[model samples]
Target: MRSVLAACLLLGLAHTARAEAPLTLRFVAPERYTDAQSRTGSGPTLRTTIGGLERIFRDLAGRTLHPGQSLTVDVLDVDLAGTDLPGAGPTAPRLVTDVTPPRLRLRYALRERGRVVLAAEETVTDINFLLRARPGGSSSLAYERDILAAWFGARIARREPPRG
Candidate 1:
């Protein structure tokens, strides 16, 4: 058993040595509002759920964002019950299967770009958001999809800029 364990550890170390560096995902926003509204919790209703939000992103962006390009999304803010925040609710940290059904709700605000990258404040939420960008060919939906994927720890997508 000891020999087998040693062999396994050696193999694992070899694989690790060869493993590629993880792709870095940047959260440029200074603040991110993450709201998780469970269907079986006391949370409020949201316009969209986490899985629904993920689907929307995939639909919008086609799932292949190259590198260097960015997608900007507007995170809405709301007051949510059962939060860790002070005065969050009568009963905070509620269970997922509680009789209190989690409605579609907006629980927090992501007011700054720096917060998103540095703090991970909004990564925790199951929410929907709008996007803004300069005039470009990729259309809003495509940009959104790419941005969403990037936010979910996927590789980035980029388009070559025009040149003479």
Candidate 2:
């Protein structure tokens, strides 16, 4: 009886110690401008590169990830194909420009069990932060980042978890 009870206890402890599998996600750029200026007083037709926008994504991800835990990012360029636009002229017909007309964009999605459970869209803005983070450590702003980091299997953080 003692051995049987000990065996059951060991099994229960092992099960409790087990962690869920880790999740992975591929990041991609969503359609939109990294930065754009209003044409209040028009001059010449113009466009801007999305280089600054990519930097914004990198910054956000870096902060959300487990401290030093480097995230594996597969950045897919944003698709802006078949968008209708008529030039500032009267006779100009609608034009469909390639999504990668200028600066490139990428999408970031969280994955686990070989599926994407959460996602978010971010565009590069010339002005200020493309998007703001939620209040506190709720990670409420983004479900993908918040949930995955907390429950995602395998510790990604290089530093020790914060002790309460």
Candidate 3:
């Protein structure tokens, strides 16, 4: 009985160790990203922005992916939804206008059961972000998060064919 219990425990431990996160994220040359840093004094810092994005990606993958499916994302560039007005004070809000849309560029790979199923480099943008009816009302990084969610739904979650 003792030996059987030990074997069962070992198996459980091994299974737990083999479980993997649905999403893995990497940011390349974040300093060179177009608009990743905080522009306002009270805005989120660089680390905060990156952390928030990682959380969003992980959440999306967790909700949308199957048990054996995983996604890896390498973020190449980011241009936020709004532009900071020239000479605006540190406390001034980032101005959102029709022309200043949110943009994100990323390379991603989707895998299932240790096999690569899809991969692509994509540039995502929402030109009419401000005009669209968004469900989340003015949350932190709301515009950026919305665009990322849309991209995840259309590309990664859909399990589209790999692009050349």
- Which is the leading candidate under lDDT? 3
Per-residue accuracy of model 1 over 1-164 as CA lDDT, tens digit each: 99999999999998765442122222223133344443444433343333344455444444442332324343343223233334455334433222222222212221122232211234222233223322453331233343344444421233222122
C-alpha RMSD in Å of predicted model 2 compared with the true structure: 16.8
All models: lDDT?
Answer: 0.35, 0.34, 0.79
Question: Between candidates 2 and 3, which one is better according to lDDT?
Answer: 3
Question: By the TM-score metric, which is better: model 1 or model 3?
Answer: 3
Query: Which candidate model has the greater lDDT, 1 or 3?
Result: 3
Model 2 agreement with the true structure over 1-164: per-residue lDDT tens digits: 99999999999888655422122334334233322222322211112213332344455545555422333444444322122233344322223232322222333345344454444333311111122323443221132232223322322333222222
The per-residue C-alpha lDDT of model 2 at residue 78 equals 31
Q: What does candidate 3 score on TM? A: 0.79
| Residue runs of model 1 more than 4 Å from their true location after superposition | 1-9, 13-34, 38-147, 150-155, 159-164
* Order of the predicted models by TM-score, top scorer first: 3, 2, 1
Models sorted by lDDT, best on top = 3, 1, 2
The better-scoring model by lDDT among 1 and 2 is 1
Cα lDDT tens digits, model 3, 1-164, are 99999999999998876676668789999999988776555445678778878887887777888998878899999887777665565445677788888888999888898798888888888887877637656665788878878787878778655344
How accurate locally is residue 52 in candidate 1, as Cα lDDT from 0 to 100? 46
Model 2 lDDT at residue 21: 16
User: For candidate 1, what's the RMSD?
Assistant: 14.0
